[model samples]
Target: MIKQILPSEVVAVDVREDPPEATLFPEEEALVAAAVEKRRREFRTVRHCARLALAELDVPPSPLLRGERGAPIWPAGIVGSMTHCAGYRAAAVGRSEVVSTIGIDAEPHDRLPDGVLDAVSLPAERVRHAALAGADATVHWDRILFSAKESVYKAWFPLTGRWLGFEDADITIDAEAGAFQARLLVPGDTAEGLYLTGFAGRWLVQDGVVTTAIAVLR
Candidate 1:
């Protein structure tokens, strides 16, 4: 399902269950050693998916560690993102020469928790969400908006090494096209010399999950 939203340059792998064979490297285990069972399982399985995606690019498996802001430290020359939610875990990776950055997220297909919509969205976005919900009551636009912002931040941080607040970007959802665009409100240049302005991403709602992805090419 995650592969459906990402570009061909990216390699995506997803699984609905934790593979019993999935085991975290010692370093990774120590990172989650104090966490609850659920946290440990998700952490382990998500990395499992990440390694599979990396292997698709002929990259050898390595201990996927966390860096600034807890983002996964990918192998050199690789850009990737990982996300997990109830019953879903996925990872997407790409060669840095072909892809500059990648961000992906997944969430259960449900309404945002009370007050979460307002906290994570601009007023204009809320207005648009109302319009979308009024038109089609089947999809959860608020949750998708939150997930898109997450993807935007994930893609943004690796390039700029900065924190992007929920209000930092204005998201517009194109319900019919299964896509969204994020206009960055902050001003900065990416490390690669590109003026960081906005991002275009794709979203999908399927089989009780909502997934969003952004991949910026070099």
Candidate 2:
């Protein structure tokens, strides 16, 4: 499920399983044992990714547990984030020393559902974003917005010990650079208000799948 994209400084991974394979943890099995087939399959996908990561670090293949609010926490000093969807799964790891905030997201290369854009973006955001990224933009605006929010959650939770909503961060895609710049509207008391220094985003569309990464500045 993981393909190392960034060097050791930033680790990125991707998975290709409907509903993903790394969602299950040992503790969740009992609760979900009687769940429908679809849910069980999804859990298997997520746990596979998590277990592979633990094994690589020589840890047991037990389920990767989540703390309050579903934040994944591994034993000992490792810091990372887990992301899985209907089509893929991924995890980003940075040895506790250098990595500050890391986030990865995968979205299908499809059009936004009706009214979905309005729910995610305000009128001004929609206008400013298009101006910020004129023509020749290959990436879709809604996907960029959704991916940016996911990354923010992954990167911010560990640093701040707090939760942020989707409206907390905003993004402007830079087509020329093949990336996007994100601005943090509200970092909250976590990390002493981690204002947006900047976000280095990398986007890829492979075999009709769209995956993007937003590694928070150190």
Candidate 3:
């Protein structure tokens, strides 16, 4: 399902069920030792999807840890992202030499909690959402808008190592094309000597889930 939105250079794996073989490393286990069963299950299953994606690139299985901001620390030369929602887990990875960053997120296909839409979105974005919703009332534009910002932040953080507030980027969605663009209100310089001003990504709504992804190539 996630692969439908990503480019061919990326390896995307998603699962609707928790695999029995999805075991966690001791380090990863320790991080979620005190959490409830649901937390543990999602965490373990998502890493399993990540490992499977990594293996496709000939990368050996290893402990996938987290760096600052809780982003998954991928194997060297790899850029990736992971997301899990009710009844779904997904991971997407790519060679860093070809892809600078990757961001992916999934959410249940439903409206945002009351006030969440205003909190996470800029006024212009909200106006756009209204226009979109008016055109096609079947889709949950607010949820997809939130997911797009999440993907934008996920793609932004690994390079800048900074926090991206929900209000930091303005998202524009193209409902017909199943695509979106995030224009950064606060641009930053990356370690790779690139100044990121915006990101273009794709979105999908299917089988009761909404997914968004961004992959920036070098």
Write down the TM-score of every candidate.
Answer: 0.99, 0.79, 0.99
Instruction: Tell me the lDDT of model 3 at 188.
Output: 80
**Runs with alpha carbons beyond 4 Å of true place in candidate 3:** none
lDDT by residue (11-39, candidate 1, tens digit) is 99999999999998999999999999999
lDDT of 3 by residue, 104-157 (tens): 999999999999998899999999999999999999999999999999999999
Query: Once model 1 is optimally superposed onto the true structure by TM-score, how far is the C-alpha of residue 196 displaced, in angstroms?
Result: 1.2
* Residue 171 displacement in candidate 2 (angstroms): 0.9
Instruction: Give RMSD to native, each candidate.
Output: 0.6, 3.5, 0.6
Better of 1 and 2 by TM-score: 1
Worst 10 residues of 2 by lDDT: 1-10
User: Backbone collision count in every prediction?
Assistant: 0, 12, 0
Candidate 2 deviant stretches above 4 angstroms: 1-5, 11-13, 18-25, 128-138, 187-198, 216-218
Per-residue lDDT of candidate 2, residues 1-218 (tens digit) = 23433445655444675443245656868656898987776566656665666556665665566687877766565677776656676776665666666677767766679887777775666886577446536656667666666776776677777777666667676655656666667734556465444456766656556666755445
The prediction achieving the highest lDDT against the true structure is: 1
